[model samples]
Target: MDTKSLLIDTATTLFQQKGYKSVGLTEILKACNVTKGALYHHFPNGKEELLITCLHGLNEVITTDIKAIFSRHLSTKDAILSMIDKLILNFEKNDTIIGYTFSSIVSEMATMSEPVRIACSALYENIQNLYHEKLLTEGYSNESASAIALLLTASIEGAIMLCITQNSATPLKTIATLLPSILEVNK
Candidate 1:
């Protein structure tokens, strides 16, 4: 890829592997094989700006994937179950070292940088909104859709954390198996 994208990807990977506080611009440049000039040319404000950009990039990727999943599934339960499966597959494919990049950074930077915090918050809301829209398309009322979406988002995040902490995808699998019952509507 290009130098700017390389720097961002390298920085993001490092941040996810390590943390924003622990990663430095020099390390990012070294890992990316770019220079200070190249990094600054793209990220004028340096590491913090790069962090925000990386978070936005992650958000765009995830949001697009979620939207596509919703479109493909049509049914809310199908979409959620598919998402859980995909998440587990992705974690396994990446050896479980990769995860929501923003989550790792946001917890550390939330009190330090408003921009970083806002970016993280906006990403989460976008995810929730995607869930909400998909549930609406599945014919749920607005109130039920909103609540279910929020619960799904929270549960999925928690499941991911459990998968990471436990070093297994069982949590995600369990969630996938149990989630549909939660989404089921009685006639």
Candidate 2:
């Protein structure tokens, strides 16, 4: 990857491990092996700007992953289970999830920055829509699909936060068990 891409990747990883507020530009610089001048050149507005870009990029990456996973499975339950399984594996490998670290970053910085708040909201909306589309595909009504999508996104994000804080993947595993019931359709 190029300097800008490398910087965003490095910063995203750091922001995932520690929320945006806890990470420093110097650390990002060191991690990416790029100079502050290069970072400023790519993100003239600075760290917040870079973080917003990273957030947007992370959302797109997640949306892509969910879309692919959803397409691979005809059933919503299987798709979501596969997703959770993937999450569990990733969390086991990294101890901190890649794009999944998003919730805490948003919770930490949303009120402090309008751009960050907007980015986080957009990310949530996009993920919800992905689930909503899947539910609709599986014969759910629009209202039910919307509600379930909201519930799923909130539950998964909350579980990720708990897993991160508790230093264990039990919360995610527990949530995975509950998803099948949550995803059940009455239609």
Candidate 3:
């Protein structure tokens, strides 16, 4: 990979594992075997700018992957189940789900950094909007669809954090079992 791509990839892994503030530019440079000048050449504004770039790239990845997963199933209920299943698969494969989630980073930065806050908020809103649209298409009223979408989004994110914190898939499994009932969908 090129220097810029290598730097981003390295930083992404570090950020995922240790968070944004914990990882320094020097660490990223060391991992990538690049000089500070190289990093500056690619990212003029430094770590924050690179993080923003990473966030944007992560948003694109999430949007595309989620749409692809949900598109295969015609029914909203099926699509949601598919998504939950995919989440389970992802969690099972990687003990630490990095790029797929950045809630920790958002919580740490939201109050302090306006740009990061806006980017995180926009990413969440887009996902919620997508869920709302799917629910509406499935015959739910607008208000009910939006409420349910928000509930599902909140629940899933919480489940991910809980699962990671506890180092077990129990939270995910429990949530999956309750989701159909919570959404009032017969499965």
- Which residue pairs clash within candidate 2? none
CA lDDT of each candidate?
A: 0.84, 0.89, 0.81
Looking at model 3, which ten-residue stretch has the lowest summed lDDT? 178-187
Clashes counted in candidate 1 amount to 0
Stretches of candidate 3 off by over 4 Å are 185-187
Could you tell me how far off, in angstroms, the CA of residue 90 lies in candidate 2 after the best superposition?
1.0
Q: Which lDDT tens digits does candidate 2 get at residues 47-131? A: 9999999998999899999999998999988998899889888889988676777988888999999989999999999999999
Q: Which order, best to worst by lDDT?
A: 2, 1, 3
lDDT of candidate model 3 versus the reference: 0.81
RMSD in Å for candidate 2, one decimal?
1.1
Per-prediction TM-score: 0.93, 0.96, 0.92
lDDT of 3 by residue, 43-128 (tens): 99999888887777778887887788778877666777787777787778888565677777787788889988988888788778
Model 1 stretches astray by more than 4 angstroms? 97-99
Best by lDDT: 2
| Shift of residue 117 alpha carbon in model 1, Å | 0.6
Best by TM-score: 2
